[model samples]
Target: MEEISKHTIHEQDIVEMILSIGKKFERIVLRGAYEDILALFKKLKKKEQSPQHYYQEQYDQYQPSAPPIPPDSAELFDYYCSFEVHDCYEQVDFEGKGLVDNVYVPLLEKVCNIHPSLLECQRKRTYKYSGWAFNALGRVSHFLETTKLEEMNVDACECLQMLWDEVQVFGFELSWLAPQVEFALNMEKFMREVEKLEEEKKTIFMRIQELRMKFKEELYFLYI
Candidate 1:
């Protein structure tokens, strides 16, 4: 039997490791490594090929004849849980933390365990954590709501503001990733329509510029 070295990985280990890392990392690196990891997986999937043999000329232009159906139920549950968190946080319900504790945390744990993908993983984690943080901060705001202006401690308010700012930062990052992924997927479709290539490219570029301007001018203010 061949000894497994530190750098050598068995096929199943690779999948589990990819899934585990998928939960923790930022998107850029996660996406950048996708093709190589996928290639490795393809190799492992074939009975006749060694891991390196899968990338040779014999495997060139090979494609899966059938596309796998996306697991919609799991995706839908994550999205629903995410929306609930958003709604609860925005409503400024001081007891929103209860909902987060009972609902959002479990959703987050399940999503992480499933390791859906980087975009969804980051979105779920950020949404749940940010909602919980925001809800806690809201409770602090409620406390200050009842306290006389003169009785409020500057330090506590400052700390709460900092926590709120962190939540906003995470929310902004999560929101940006969602639209960016949408743009990427749309770009793929747009590129495929050869007859409309020039026009669609122009439209996509223009829309991207518009999104940037709106994000800077409108969304920035609201979050701040």
Candidate 2:
């Protein structure tokens, strides 16, 4: 009886560790995927602007005054395909697709390849374990009503053992996924920092341009 209790405690510890690792892995994968999609959008922004230089020249000559409409998903996909770096992923069809299907899932798969199964486990495990817990509680309740203490103990121990085994399997999977998860997370952080620096550079250049224009205006006024 004492040995059974010790084993149950050990299993509980493993379960907690598995849950913590699984949650962390899920969060990192999702966050990294989101950042990757944002990076693609940034690339699309640069591509969309490439044509604008020509438009600006034409506008200076003709004074055309059409406001730009934002690109829809299809347009974004087209621009995404135009990038040489993303040529490998261009064949991925995005027709009538949601963000998760087109962007997050694809990026996650590119990084780790185990994303689908990991996502399934992350989403389903809670509900799966909750159902098992409820069923086990009901059985324990019935056993108590019948005054069957030994049976109740056995049933509870079985539930614990099942949970322990599931946790072990999940932990093993996460162990292999850990390196990829860390890489994705670090890549996301690097992308964000690069974007921030680019924005700052743009801001500084605009300020310098504004100062130059102001200096020209002052010189013109002085000459007048």
Candidate 3:
């Protein structure tokens, strides 16, 4: 159909499908689409119609559409959760200073025993008892701290934010993961900003290259 219509006639239809696809959220899993969906949701929130203006007609109502979850819910389902922390630890040595067994495991066991109705608590928090999980969290952190923002995994940062959100309301001060969560959320804005800057960097570099050429030279290096 795209070949026949040249992707023009179905453009609005495609947009509508994207807007209505609440259940099929994996379609917007990438950070770029995730941000766009957020921007639209924010626009709807900001320009909400007055109560008087909204139901003025006979049985007619003007309702702005909304997404299934809020903008930040993207990484709430941590994709990294499936990878086993135990497996990561089998080949290496990582001591928890007696914190893993006496503290982490006991807390996790208690949470699992909770009635599922309470908080819908899925006790899947990573305690970094494994060397890999520890380093993986730091992998993106390393990128964020340095100039290589593009290398950082936005999903990891977002998962940290979601975890922090849960921990805040967990009724106690679990100081264990607090600092790591702070570090993750503090630099979350760079996920979008660095992407924007990369695109702008490309445009500027392309223009500069074009100007550097006498309308005829071609040189290729890194674009962004």
Candidate 4:
């Protein structure tokens, strides 16, 4: 029974260690994404004024055929939020197929274990936002490839701003996973404590056994 308990504790410890490593990897990936977004934001900000000026002029001159959809409509909002206006001058396609698959999808699957509907909503939102980002980045790449230096600066600023917005939205959606992550972290800590206690118990048991042996030997000597 003692041996079985030890084996079970050892297996639990291994599982907890693996989970700790997985959490660390997730945090590292998130930090990398955050840094990338910050760099992109700074790059766009430097050239953003030019594109804003041009867009404002265009906005003032253009007439809309249809009124904009209300933000409260979930389906419409999701579609609108994910919408990307593809530029004709796009030179390269964005490789977005595996972006969500790499992290968000798997994370959502884990979250679904806690709340399936919440997971579904978050998953949809994540994909929409990430898809918009992919499209925006693709447009930026296109502009860089085909546009003159001045035009590239303007388009890059515009596309990068769009991409930045999508990334921000994606980050917000991802934050919903925080509670689950916290719970998992707490569980890992609890498991560590359990492992420590188990070790202490084993040591105390071994000491008790040694004292029992000593008592038996003294009793035998007295009898002799």
**Best by lDDT, which number?**
4
Model 2, C-alpha of 61: deviation from truth (Å): 53
**Cα miss at 99, model 2 (Å)?**
30
TM-score, cand. 1: 0.19
Off by over 4 Å in 3: 1-154, 174-180, 186-188, 213-224
Query: Candidate 3 clashing pairs?
Result: none
For model 2, the superposed segments whose C-alpha errors exceed 4 Å read: 1-176, 211-224
Give the distance in Å from residue 155's predicted Cα in candidate 4 to where it truly belongs: 39
What does candidate 2's lDDT look like per residue over 129-164, in tens digits? 422322222222222223222232333334333323
How are the candidates ranked when ordered by lDDT, highest leading?
4, 1, 3, 2
TM-score of each: 0.19, 0.20, 0.28, 0.25
Candidate 1 lDDT, 44-110, residue by residue in tens:
3453332224323443332111000012222443343331112222122212222232323333334
Q: What 10-residue stretch in candidate 1 is worst by lDDT?
A: 62-71
State the TM-score for model 2.
Answer: 0.20
Report the C-alpha displacement of residue 84, candidate 3, in angstroms: 5.9
Clash pairs (backbone) in predicted model 1: none
Give candidate 2's whole-model lDDT.
Answer: 0.33
Q: Model 1: runs farther than 4 Å from truth?
A: 1-98, 101-133, 172-224
Q: Which ten residues in a row have the lowest lDDT in candidate 2?
A: 62-71
Error of 1 at 15 (Å): 88
